[model samples]
Target: MNAFPPAQALSGRRPAVAVWPWPIALGLLTVFGLLSALLGQHGIWLALSWAALSLPLIVTVICLVRAWSRPSDKGGRS
Candidate 1:
């Protein structure tokens, strides 16, 4: 038997949010950052590329920290 239901089953409704935008935006930013860093390695392009690259990393760290801080669904706490 399953210990818990899937999130979709629990929700039982379509999500209003469109999921593709953020991921697409992040991917574009990464691509731009890479191309800029490699192809435009001198002035403003380099700086913008660095900034763009760091944003994804910053988002990832923030998400990881938030997920780790949350209590586990498996009930680790007594």
Candidate 2:
């Protein structure tokens, strides 16, 4: 008999094909934000800096909300 339940059985599945595009994009935004801050302190540069910094913050809040709203596994934890 199998030691694990069918749902818990291990398999040699293929790895995920997903890429880190969002992280790379966020990093690029951070660099641009820094450059904008460095080059000047007014008008469009300020707007670009705020937007670049805010994008990552918005992403983080969205991820946190999704994670928090996801249902927890009843059988996995106390």
Candidate 1 backbone collisions, by pair: none
lDDT of 1 at 13: 53
| TM-score for each model | 0.65, 0.67
Candidate 1's residue-wise lDDT over 1-78, tens digit each?
Answer: 123345644565533556788789889999999999899988999999999999889888987776567656433221
Clashes of each: 0, 0
CA deviation > 4 Å runs, candidate 1: 1-16, 72-78
Candidate 2 versus truth, CA RMSD in Å, comes to 8.0
Report the Cα lDDT for residue 4, model 2: 35
Per-residue C-alpha lDDT of model 2 across residues 1-78, encoded as one tens digit per residue? 113333433343333434778889999999999889789789999999989988999998987776566557333211
CA-lDDT, candidates in order: 0.73, 0.70
Error of 1 at 36 (Å): 1.1
Tell me, by lDDT, which candidate is best. 1
